[model samples]
Target: MSTIDTSKPHSARMYDYFLGGKDNYPVDVAAAEQVTSLFPAVSQMARTNRAFMHRASRLLAERGVRQFLDIGTGIPTEPNLHQIVQATAPDARVVYADNDPIVLRHAEALLHSAPEGKTAYVQADVREPGRILAVARETLDFTQPIALSLVALLHLVGDEDEPVRIVRELVESLAPGSYLTLSHATGDFDPETWERVVEVYRKGGTAAQVRSREEFSGFFTGLELVDPGVVLAARWHPDLGARQGGEEIPLYVGVGHKS
Candidate 1:
């Protein structure tokens, strides 16, 4: 089992706390509550992000893409990426990656793949794109179309981390028709609230770099964006689905084809 340090607040566990799940520690709940005070929509944002992920996965399955590489995968939630894809295409294969030890410890939930499909977890960081790709290749074919999802993950990556470079490496490794699905927190909606939330994360020992629409869109350079390009999470293909708990929050979601 992966060791979980309950002293610090982890993004995944904090996220789980925000969603009213029991897997989070007191520290995570504290941090999540503090952030919630600043931006009450944070929990809604979490649900929205999950909904977008479901829609994206369904679109990929409908498009005949059977392999998925989800980086920065958080604690396994119900109807996870594998569940959504496998519900439509039973033979789908998925590789979940996250640096969080807590996620690795609870990864058993993610391992329950459909009998005809494959679900595996890799204990790795998003910055280590090559390593993730290498291990994921065992389950996913590099020559075929695979959907790469980084939903609500990039904001945690600070400026010094060179997120753009990491994305470049991952994008270059994928074949044409492979898609990149992303949803990130932005300061555009409410700058003051975003700033307060960023401070909360900084105090928690994690970096949060909330980008604008242009900066978020910049991550998709060299790729072809799908229709209704890079819109708000609530607006992104809203007709496709809805959240189970509550209304969707303000987030930007987009899907881009490698070629």
Candidate 2:
């Protein structure tokens, strides 16, 4: 297990704080406060992004996707990926991967699967796709369709990490008919505010790079995008329960089928 570092603010912990979760440290709170001060709608943005994940997972389950692999799984909040999918399809199998030790400590909350389903957790980083897939295979059958969820995650992966290539690698590993569900923070709406937000994260020892719509769309290069593709997180399949509020949250989301 990796040691829990409370010394510096972690993106995951800061996100937890944004979501009103108690799993974060004072450092995380201080950094998140700075971000909130910069963009007061940040907490709403976080909640909107989270809602997209829930709706996407349930929609995929309804479409007969029986397996899921969620990378950068943050602190467990209610209605987690597994819970939402299993509620839609009781036999759904979910594998969660996160590098955060605080998330590892709360992994138990993510394991309460339905009797007909299964769930597993991998304490690995998104940069280590091989390790995540290896552990996920223990619970998910890669031969069939699976939902690869990267909700609110890729933005934390700086350009140095080659995030697009990482997404390509993960998607290529999946079987045809699988889906990639992603939501990312974007600076297209209010660039100046987001720039300051990025600075705050970097100062707290976290690397963050909010992308533009074109850059965000590149992640789904060869996949067939679902309807209303690559729109604001609130606008994607709004009927599925995502709030279609008038305020634009600086987040882009989409679902694509690997056919």
Candidate 3:
């Protein structure tokens, strides 16, 4: 396991702080505070994003997606991807990947699988799509449909990291009928406030880039989008009982099928 760096703020840890999780350090708290000071609704946005992940995971599982590969999995919050999907389909298999060593330290919480299901965690960065897919194959069958979830993750990946290419590589590795579920923070609603938030993250030593709606939609260039495509995070499948009145949340979310 890599050593956990406490000097500089990490996106995963900072996110944990936003979600009211206690797994973060002082550095993360400071950075999260800076973000909140810039955008008061940031914490609400984080919670809403998490709710979207739960809804998407359960919907895919209900639609017969038995395997899930969730990259950029943050600190283990209760009712994680495996928990949500496996609840609907106990035989569901889930593989989680994240680069944060602190997340790795708390990975035990993520490994509690349902008796009929299985779960595994990989300490890998999203940039290393090959490694993630390779390890995920050990648990998830690449020949069957799998839901590739990148929830509230890509914004931390700057343009230089080639996030779209990363998504393409991961999606290409899955079989036909595979699904891609993504939720990313966007600056389309309030670009100026988001710009300041990005600078806060950069000064804290983390690469942050909020995208426009068009740029966010580019990730699903070839895949077929599901109903109510590319809307605010809360608008995607709200029948799943996601939080209400999230119109101000500056995040774009959608799920697509690889037909």
The list of candidate 3 runs beyond 4 A from truth reads: none
Stretch of 10 with least lDDT, candidate 2: 241-250
How well does each candidate superpose onto the true structure, as a TM-score?
0.96, 0.98, 0.98
- Report lDDT (CA) for all predictions: 0.89, 0.91, 0.91
Worst 10 residues of 3 by lDDT: 241-250
**TM-score: model 2 vs. ground truth:** 0.98
lDDT string, candidate 3, 1-259, tens digits: 6998999999999899988899889999998998999999888988998888988888899999999999999999988999999889999999999999988998999999998999999999999999998899899999999999998889989999999899989988989999999999988878899999999999987788999999999999999999999999878888987564468788899999999
Candidate 1: residue 202 Cα off by (Å): 1.4
Candidates ranked by TM-score: 3, 2, 1
Candidate 2 per-residue C-alpha lDDT over 1-259 given as tens digits, one digit per residue, 9 for 90 to 100: 7899989999999999889989888999999999999999888888898888888898999999999999999999998999999998999999999999989999999999999999999999999998988898899889999899998999999999999989998999999999999999899978999999999988987779999999999999999999999898878888888563444788999999999
Over 1-259, each residue of candidate 1 has an lDDT whose tens digit, in order, gives 5687888898999998877788888898999999988888788788888988999889889999999999999988898999999999999999999999978888999999999999999999998998999899888998999899999999999988999999989988999989999999989978888988988898887888899999999999999999889988877777778543333365888999987
In candidate 3, residue 250 scores what lDDT? 83
